[model samples]
Target chain A: PDPDAAAVQAAMARNGQLTKPPGALGRLEDLAIWMAGWQGTDRPHVDAPQVIVFAGNHGVTARGVSAFPAAVTEQMVLNFRAGGAAINQLARCFGARMDVHALSLELPTADFTIQPAMTEAELLEALQTGWDAVDPASDLLVTGEMGIGNTTSAAALAHAICGGVPADWVGRGTGVDDAGLALKAQVVAEGVALHAQARADGIEALRCLGGRELAAMAGAILRARHLRIPVLLDGFICTAAAASLDAAKPGALDHCLAAHVSAESGHAPLLAHLGKAPILSLGLRLGEGSGAALAIGVIKGAVACHSGMATFAEAGVSEG
Target chain B: PDPDAAAVQAAMARNGQLTKPPGALGRLEDLAIWMAGWQGTDRPHVDAPQVIVFAGNHGVTARGVSAFPAAVTEQMVLNFRAGGAAINQLARCFGARMDVHALSLELPTADFTIQPAMTEAELLEALQTGWDAVDPASDLLVTGEMGIGNTTSAAALAHAICGGVPADWVGRGTGVDDAGLALKAQVVAEGVALHAQARADGIEALRCLGGRELAAMAGAILRARHLRIPVLLDGFICTAAAASLDAAKPGALDHCLAAHVSAESGHAPLLAHLGKAPILSLGLRLGEGSGAALAIGVIKGAVACHSGMATFAEAGVSEG
Candidate 1:
């Protein structure tokens, strides 16, 4: 569904009369107007915001690209279920439901440096799983990922889709030392090179080089856009999914908002390619949708200001 | 009251045991530790965060230094009271109680370009009023202002305290035109020159050129520190108040956290002088304590993560 152009115009007009000087609210004013358009109402309300964490395991963990072993991925999934993860606490704080989908944790993606990460059928199943994860009643959606060593896969995919060198895209995932970072970069370069033909094709790139979690998040974002629900994107791996989705289906980001600029080195370049400006820059690198959950309240405040602030005439205040 | 160093160390120790890699949470980890220190507990909770907006009138409005008239200050106070302002909505979203203090808005401050903005007695009273406004039971406090031309007063105060020329400190308040900005700079320069001696003294400088709201905010910050409650400093004007308090008391900002960097040019310099890095940088210029109110949720999430996340041992996850 297309955003309501008329509602956006109405929001802009109402914002001009909101008792403050013109443009005093800055990016907040833009956010409110965007919400208005997305909701097809002059007064949009943030209701039933949901955060979905897609967890998977990556074969690249064998390459020592991440600080933690691949087994931590399943362990963190159990932790999310036990309500002890950062995303769980943050989701509760925002009154957003938390959904954890362990997408093939028992069967980790193939080591992309040696072979394609997944076959076409496995990639299709993962995408379908993500598409079905969205709740119809959800007014807003935020996507997060929990996969050990997936950053290496994301970096390879980003290098393939976004055309950056592996060194530029690879970062210190989970606080790796300088030597580990160098090894991670080498692994990503080899992975991208091994899948050069598949990298030329968008969907094939996910099958060849991306982890299940990244592919799932890409599917979820596409589904949310199709359902006309706004998606708040978490850090680098999630954004790499969105970047690939944009490659396959352009304009998929019309319903998405960049929650924060991740501390990861490649995230800035990815966001720059997507032409998105994040709401927060707290140097966050946590990836279980924690940044998105933290941002829910800020987005709510923007919607509240759009719907609740009195006009200058109502407040009897002189306009600038 | 000094923050509890033991609690901070304990919080840092627990952070290392979280399921993710060490320092993966970035500044969030620091924020959680700071909260623990400030609250004097290993598990600090942001239970009753409060936002107080101190509204006043600035005499410099008569010189066209601001886009809005001075009367808008009182009107905004009424708007805040009626719960129809941006701060009101943000407070509700964060579950924070909102308070509006109208500080002698009927009698605007004296024109600082010609004479002192307030007498020493008036400045003392304003400071005391702000001190008294802090709720005894509140765990966190956010300070904001609602004066149209107070930015000029704040710029003048910042210039005096931080020792920058008027051109360096003055900015477009409430979307002032280029000509209006030039006039504001000229007015601030003249005001600073007129009170050069008082400018050498911190509190005396506030009396010579600061509006009642800024003095009151300085007072509130000082009182919050004395009471051991963490203060979330708003944009330029509020930061100027914190800067002034720092100069007078030398350690007043020990309990303060910068909420965001405002669009106002003077705010960056002011924050740099105070050795503070803001959490959000949304280019917000609206000052009804909105930025601080918006940040309450982020701070709360950090605290929640610190207290609720599972340790690596608890989750059976191997640390790198």
Candidate 2:
């Protein structure tokens, strides 16, 4: 289903009537109009926003592709539950309902450098877990991931689906050094080389090269679209997951906004490939939906100005 | 007084100890540390952010330099007072204390195309009005403006002090058309040529070409620097006011950050001249400190992540 065109029209009319000059609020006015279409209201408010973080362990950690150990995934998930992580603070600050799902952190995915990252059944279950995680009543959705060495899997997935070389898709994830970056690129090449057929099918690529958390993000994004909930896709891993959906079905990401381009070198090019402009770009790379979670404030400000400002007539201010 | 070096060092050390990898927070980490230095604490928060909107009338409207009538200045000030403007909503959304001051709205400044915009006495009073309006206890300051034909005055000021052509300093302010834009550049050129002596002195340039509201903004920014309150400069007009301060004394704007690059054509080059990279580029052209007010949320998020997140040892998350 498409956005409500009538609501968009009403919002656009109201935006012009507001006290400032037409389009002076810039992208914020556009954001508010976008929210209006998705929420089916001329005056849209994101009263209920959901932030779901899925955690999965990656066997690719064995390749030493990341700076942190795989155990840190479970630890960070615990930190989230304890409300001690950056994501927790940001979500709380922006009034988001945050939930954490640990998808078999004890069961590491098969390393795509050697074999498929997940069996078909495992992939299906992970996607199902993501689909079920979204709250249909929530007006906005933000999906985050917690996994060590998942960036390597994301790089391989992008290489497979986006037709980029392994080097173009690889970057220093979680503060890897020069040697580690080189090794990660080599690993992405090997994964893409072995899973050649995956390049033609996004879902097959997800099964072959993406971890549970990445697949879960794809599922959550897809569900958000069905529920008419606007999605703010996070950095590299989350974007790659969303890219899988776009690759599987072009225009699947029309309801989504790129939250921010991360410090990861691949993120800029990836966002360009998707033709999505990011809301914020502060070089953030901490991928627990931190950037998007922070951007919740930007969205709220946009909506508030669009809805709350007085029209020229109401304010008795003359206009051209 | 300069920012506290000891506090900055302490904050940087604490940042490295946080659960995330070093520098993953990107420019936000820098913002947090900058906040720490200004607040003189290892854990900095903008608890009392003061948003001051100074409104005045510009005689330049006589030159058909603006889309709105001069009466709209007072009307918009009333709009600000009634909480019916975009800046009001943004400040409220970000939990800032917003204040509106109309600096002699009934007495429009002299048109700079014919003569100096203000006498030295009048400019000093306007500057004093701005300097006195800032609350010394406030931790952060954002100065906004509401004046008809003020962008023309700002363009003239930037031209005299920043060594730019009038065309380079003029834009379609308040939604003026191409003819109005040309007229505005001519107005700026005439003002700068007549007051060419102001080219060497920012204060002189401000007196010759800047409106009361712009002088007030300059005064407010200077007072903020003296009080060690970090300032978030708004779009073109506000940046021009800050540029006057920087022109009077090099490095005077070290305590300020460019809040956003506005849709006004002159803003980007003006910011480049000041050597300040804007935080947001949303094409926002609505003054009244709307862009900077919106950025209050970003500063809060940066502070929250820097101050509220648990350290690696506290969260029991492994660090390199």
Candidate 3:
């Protein structure tokens, strides 16, 4: 569903009446208008914001494509549940509830370098699982993922959908050294080349190269769009899933906000393709919705400005 | 005085024990340590944060150096007092108290192109006014400014302290057109040239080329440092004041944080010279401490994570 144009118009009108120079708030004014449009109201509140973290294990860890072992994914899930992770602390600070789901941690996907990551039926099931994770009462939904070697799978999937060289999409995952980074790049290249023809199709590419967690994130984004819940996307991995979802469902991005530009090499181009500008650029590469959680505060401030501040007429202030 | 090294060390050690990857929080970890060191405690809070906006008028506004007229400064002061300005909204959202001071607005400073902006005594008084605005009970101090054609004065000050050409230090202020920007650059060049000998001295440059508000912000920053209250520096105008403070005191930046890289062209080089990295890059150009207000939330989040998160031993999570 498209955003309500009349509500967007109402928001812009209200912004003009605010007792400041025109366009003084810069991107914040745009953020408020976008939120208003999505909420279909001139005054919108960020009610029941949520950060849903989907955890899965990537088979590409077998190729030594990551700095950490695959077992860290399971451990991080436990850390998130214990409210000990960065995302957990961030979610609490921003007044957002965090939900962690270990969808396929015990059953890792097939190694994409050698075979498809998952079957079509498995991909569908992962999507459904992700779709089910969304809270019906959530006004703002943020998607995050925890998976070892997932960046390699995300890179391969990005190479398929974004049609870039694997070297361009691959980056240092979990602070890999020179040799490990080169190994990751090579793995992504080989995987993309292996799934060349099937990758042209979005679902086929997701099945061939994407992880279970990524599949679920894309499903969650689509479902959020269907429910008119504004979605805030995290860094590179989440943007890759968003790109995949956009290819399959053309208007999925209209309901989403790009939270930040990651330090990873692939995020800028993907964000550019989506016609979105990130609210933050902190060189973040952690994937458990930390960037999105930080951006939620900014969004809340924008909403407060839109809804609570007095207009120029009300304040009896002169306009420029 | 320098930050407490022992407190910083304690914070870093605590971060290491947190149940996440080392450096997983990226710059947030650095922010917490910086705050802890400044506060002289392992557990630091952003208690009673305050935003003080100094308002003045520049005679240079008559030369078409800015897109807005000089009257806008006084009008903005009223807007700020009436709680309808961007800074007002942002301050309310971040839980920071907002104070607007109209110093020298009724008596505009002399045009620096032909004469010094203020007398030595006037500059000293302005600095004292800024120093007096500091709230001793507040843990955080944010400096912002409101003055028409102030960017020209800031650019001139930047050129004097940082030694750059007019074009390098000048930018479009308040949405100036190309012609207005060129005029601003020319005005800055002439002003810097007129004060060439005096410009070599830090305090002399501030008196000869800087506005009353800039001088006050510098005093505020220095006072905040003396009181060990961590300062959050706003955009180009505020950063120019910070640059002056650093030059005068040599180590005043130790207590200050750059909030964001403004859309103005001169801000990046000023920030680089201070050896500081901004927390946000939102392309914000609006003054009045809006950028600093936006950044307070990030600082609050960093503190929350530092003080409230569970350690690895406490959470029973395995370290990588």
Model 3's CAPRI class is medium
Q: Write the per-residue lDDT of candidate 3 for residues A177-227, one digit (tens) a residue.
A: 788888988998888888888666877888899988999998899889888
TM-score of chain B of each: 0.98, 0.99, 0.98
**lDDT values of the candidates?**
0.88, 0.92, 0.87
Top candidate by lDDT: 2
**For residues B66-118, could you state the per-residue lDDT of candidate 2 as single tens digits?**
98888999999889999999998899888899999999988999988888899
Residue B120 shift from truth in candidate 1, angstroms: 1.7
Off by over 4 Å in 3: A273-275
| Model 1 CA deviation exceeding 4 Å by range | none
Which candidate achieves the best DockQ against the true structure?
A: 2
What residue pairs clash in candidate 1, if any at all?
Answer: none
Clash pairs for candidate 2: none
**CAPRI-style grade of the A/B interface in model 2:** high
**Chain A TM-score (model 1):** 0.97
lDDT of 1 by residue, A105-209 (tens): 999989998889998888988899899999977878999999989888888888998896788898987888899989988998888888899776767888888
Q: Where is model 3 chain A poorest over a 10-residue stretch in terms of lDDT?
A: A311-320
Candidate 1 vs 3: which has more lDDT: 1
Model 3, B179-221: lDDT tens digits are: 8888888998899899998666778889999999999999998
